[model samples]
Target: MKGLVGNMGIAHLRYPTAGSSANSEAQPFYVNSPYGVVLAHNGNLVNAEKLKVHLDQDVHRHINTDSDSELLLNVFAAELEKKGKVRVNDEDIFTALEGVYKLCVGGYACVGMLAGYSLIGFRDPHGIRPLVFGTRTKADGAKDYMLSSESVVLKAQGFTEWRDILPGEAVIIPKDTMTPVFKQVTQPLSYSPDIFEYVYFARPDSVIDGISVYRSHLAMGDMLAENIAKRFGGRETLSDFIDVVIPVPDTARNAALQCAVNLDLPYREGFVKNRYIGRTFIMPNQKERKSSVRRKLNAMGLEFKGKNVLLVDDSIVRGTTSKEIVQMAREAGAKKVYFASCAPAIRYNHIYGIDLADTRALVGYGRNNQEIADVIGADDVIYQELDDLVKSVLASGNNDKITGFEVGVFTGEYITGVEAGYFKHLENLREYNARFKQNSILAGDDPKAEVDIGIYNEGDY
Candidate 1:
């Protein structure tokens, strides 16, 4: 199976940790005291500190890593062993995980049972990241259920049909049984972008919760070009200007194409990424991650030198990679380097999947445009406005779907400064409280929504 699926074929239960990038951090980390457990997990636990405290003090188990996913696996596995005893069934294990965690903190993930016969899955109360599943018919005429971070994996393996798993819902995948059962964990908080999905995490041809990531990105690319050109108004010269184009890296490829078509400028590739380092998670320290970006992207100095280069990126969370690439472009003798992000100010921390840590760690958090500009070292930095952000993605009929984050957050205009600071408290709420916030944030006409009616159909998908 490992040979068949390569990376995707490896499961939480059976895979080994040797020769892996994160060997100590590998999945299916085992425990002996808790009924000989093995675990693999996705997502972060908001209350991980508290859970750790409880686990050490009460359960007498000491945690070894900083990952909330591992901590969560330990806690839940302990709970299962304690409650299930020797004869505990899959139903009992699922029920045990309920009230103990009202919030999975800020992540969406799945856990496979190593000692038991069931695979358990859960999402953050809000559908932050995406999880897709489908049933595949084997050559033997058997239908097998599969779950993954994206449907692209299924398609790559020749499984064309798939559907998204709803947020806050837990589905039980039985090992020997043909049928799967679901138990709603809690109501979904509200939908937020997995953060990474739009920028650098997911594959290009992926869909999350019914929205096409590719289409959403094309809008971002086009909007980014408009915003950047609008900001760098001084570059009106015919020759000094390199015109609108993408650098051929992951962040700006789609948007660059759209930017070129929209601006009627000749689009060309400026930088080529070494595909070897595809996508990796954003870590806490910006200093440590900058070198990795160079290992991933090399500037086409010949193409960009003496050109007023416009660099379009998906987002600039820590701005480390963007800073390096811009410096590389400038050192290569580019006339000027302009930077623009498809995302608006990512000023707040993502409690959802992006695994982006606290706002205090973000280069853009609490800082205005000027500070962010200096940090990223761009000649100019332009971001899509929050209102334009929603318009670019959600369009018309899809306006009210994101119940967790307020539409007002996307627009960046809070009507009041007090309301503007609301996201600081978003990470601390429980599932029920988070749901309440999503339900209460809106009550008026969102005059800004311009959903694309063409994307909405009555029935056939």
Candidate 2:
């Protein structure tokens, strides 16, 4: 609050994966007006493109990025300007922005406004993304409220003791008053975070929807060891030597350690990350996939040489990266390789916000586990059961139950009828109906995924 800066400052970085792969498309767009509102968003907005179209025509706003924050700021600034006032109340801003969104389907979003009369913060109802807030009192006795997609970012800046913001809830902070206003924008949509995210994307240190990301993977690793034992009970074959549990780079480290503990085997980091490669799962097509592998993964000669190793990873979506990695491991003089998936088959594509599209493009879409193992060149593969998945990722205790949105519906046991013809942000789908015909690559019932990043081609992984 006090001594913050000349005009307030906010920073944002993009982890662009599941969609396009351009830095120009990154986030943290700023107003820089006397208003000086700097906006950053973490997750996807199902309707941001639509909102952009609305802003372009109705408000004459041009978007710098394909993100919801840009669309939102345009709407807020336009609405405020339309009201012909230098400042607008929080209620007035939220009332104008509402759209259909989901959690398990992806897209957790956070919005912040600095150098404005009042700062507003919000999260998707399903909380598909993560956001945390902290407050500091300035020398001038003004309150400074800060928000980030991850709490540790603020913690690194000396912000601590954060509380989770419920989905669909918005908090308004004013300079003159320490008092805050809370408003509900829409209903809760999805689960806190996908179980796979803990096994992969999120930092193990984070708490997603109250679930400890690291701890859950530890449990998954343990479960996987048990599954492996059951699969190869009393075999004692060359492949059953059980030399060491090798993790697939960063995401599987925690789970690999846990698997070692569960199976009483040694653990080691067998693959080194490129440190410069982006997640190919987030980018579209096979070019990024090849580049990501060449730039992202390397074999650990010492850990893999002439040894029968168990390679553990969070999930194998395209089977491209994992396949290449496995081949490299074999070339590293490994006697045998066994692969394990910490979660069950990702057959269904995520409609939320993640990059996973539909079943057609999914390597495991029409294939079974053994088939996937063959494709990826692993000697054996095992996966955690779905029930155990929810149990492990969501904290277990009378008080540690999982709730934020109806994640049970995620299994497709219950379906939220898809809303169509009204989406604003997603383009290239006007031909999704009646005109769409199935080709060799587009053979599926899902219309949304008939094209690139089509929802139907995205397998569960």
Candidate 3:
């Protein structure tokens, strides 16, 4: 730890999508050639497999791991080497980054250090992810620059001036200097940012792409209340039908409070969440997720007994947690449980970064509201309308130049074009993984008996 001294340093926390969670898959991948570059990435690359092939055959670079971040580092390094310069400068970095943008497809927000020279940050052309830039001035007349995935980090660090990095743009902050040079390296393919960031991932206080996460949740609650009223008559009927409105836990608190207020229904903390337990949606597998849901939340019998209760969650990806919570409420003596999702139904895979990757895994995919409600054991399931979600999230009417947030999961319109053969590849991979999982389960159940395995590993199957 003592050896970590540097004029500038960058760090990252990654949730793996393309690769397994081995120690070798960690980020801030370094490439020490031409001019050394250390980089960390935030989003998934849709064209990573294709890029890996190009890197091997054309770029002549060897990738050690399956991580897209490693491939990205090699791509950036090759760009710098193309200049054939002993020492690299901002122009070389900019030119190299432009090449990287052209070669890569899918969401990315990256920050890196150019050896001992500069700190660099860039966002994908589509701006599918977020990147914010902040600057702080010291009494000694020196300025410091920072870039992060969200603005909350800058605010926490007491940065006085901050703004978002535009799509298709790159910024370079030279070492030991406060001044930052900015350039637009590529034309934006589309300005569609991920709406799920505001819906689920980002901190409540964060402002992503000019929308307040907390306020967005409030608007979602308002819209949800509106939808409930339209579907089930007035507050007089709702008050009798739903005795109390309860949030799933911390993330749904804002929406729950506002929903209760708008519906004229009582609001209570029905579930006491154990914060130490990680979010089940991000859990590695179904086994871990199921176990964690039980550990994470406990129902209050007093709140549920003899009363029809309404439960609210930010979104339902797999529905495992939702089903468990509904069963818990029933066990607690609740007369009936009505579940509402603040976000629209996730009917398509999120190729960007939110981890609802498999179509078959999504509970709402190819299912109606009644079918979904039955599957989750809710009396009725309610989801925010896609149009209403878009309106609520972009409530302030700011950023008129931009159209709206990416609604791929709800509308099935991929803002960035989906490749021709990608879906088939994903399905094949899913089938292989399913076989591997089945084989492992069978082996665990009967160790002494010989089992016929169709295919052994992940890819071979």
Candidate 4:
């Protein structure tokens, strides 16, 4: 990567949701049929199995990996092949993308390279995932273009004037002309971005679809503060019930700080996070997640000693990490531990890109607030109201397009409508992966094995 020099390229850090963590499944997936194209995708495809069959039977393209990104790459390549032209133009590429939109059903944002021709980026019809692009002016007055999932990256790299790619829109930047062409390939079904982006996934510094993630979290804190006050009878009595507001470090820090300020309570960092550990929520299996909690964070006895501490977290999907953290707080000499979530209880599986957990495995699935508290060993549990959470995001953004958010994890109602039988498919995939991982552990084999790679070049495009 350090030595590679290219005028146009696409890159991806694989966050496994659709397939196993095999090295072969890593992106940028390539296809060479009609015109050489490589693509890296974010988010999952609900109709991937159906598309796989279509690609195999109709398009006659052999899929080598289980990754849906690879499937997507092939889908685009197959559509381009239908053009039946040796040299394709922007219109041809966009028409192919229209074909992709007609077939693929799910949330996705993709960046692709059409060999030496152009750099392409597009988003799903519902705008369930994020995609943005920006430009920088060079010394020679030629503009350089970049695309990313987050605006923060563009801004950090001096790519000013960034804006989100609209729902169902595609942008193509030609290498020869250095000009970008934008088109709405499909009519948008809706303008809902995933609410989890503001709650957890995205960095606080990022502004997505005109909404500031940091501000939204602060608004979430204000909303949760009101709820917390109501729980203790009144704002005046908040300090009587809770001594300090301690965030489950990192993601919840902004919300916790604001909540403490609103409640007029002391804000303390009760847990010290180990910067080296990866996020536990996105870990592949339950066993790894459970074991990593302690390694990721340690309780600070000074902040918890003999105090009634209130813990704030982004959301609680499975009770594993929260339960362990509660025990840690108690051991750190906290008198009583009360837990609060800035987001509402996630009872449903996140079907988009985030692999939360199985529906039945979720702590909030069939449990009330009290039951959730008991499971997590907290004296009480406070969850943000669904309406309040939605309001928090809406109030922070000026985007008229974002009328609502994809709150499937809380309401079990996805913006893309329900994917019938998708849950069972997801459950089976998780089970198989878990079993494979366990077997690998028993056999003393590495679950993630490397694969060979080769380069191909056609005589002259």
Whole-model Cα lDDT of every candidate shown, in order: 0.60, 0.62, 0.84, 0.89
lDDT of 4 by residue, 362-440 (tens): 9999999999999999999999999999999999989987868899899988887655677777886777677766664
lDDT of 3 by residue, 1-461 (tens): 45998768898876646544446567788878867789998887778778878987798887766567788889998988899988877898999999999898888899999888999999999888999999888899778789999989999998988888888999999875647999999988878889898889899988878878899999999999999887788766877688999999988899989999999999999999898997787666788888899999999999999999999999988999999999999999999999999998898988776556588889989999999999999999999998888888889437664666778888788877776676665555444444544555444331212222122222332
- Index of the highest-lDDT prediction: 4
Q: Which parts of model 1 are misplaced by more than 4 Å?
A: 1-22, 32-37, 59-62, 81-85, 114-116, 232-242, 278-295, 348-361, 395-461
Report the Cα lDDT for candidate 1.
0.60
Worst 10 residues of 2 by lDDT: 449-458
Ranked candidates (lDDT, high to low): 4, 3, 2, 1
- Model 1 Cα lDDT, one tens digit per residue, 105-126: 5454664554445566665566
lDDT for 217 (candidate 3): 93
List pairs with backbone clashes in candidate 1. Answer: 28-39, 46-105, 125-189, 126-189, 190-404, 221-255, 386-410, 395-450, 395-451, 396-451
Q: Pick the candidate with the highest TM-score.
A: 4
Off by over 4 Å in 2: 1-7, 17-24, 30-38, 47-69, 72-86, 94-106, 136-144, 178-180, 184-191, 234-241, 274-280, 283-288, 356-359, 396-401, 404-417, 421-461
Error of 1 at 55 (Å): 2.2
Once fitted onto the true fold, the runs of candidate 4 whose alpha carbons sit more than 4 angstroms away are: 440-461
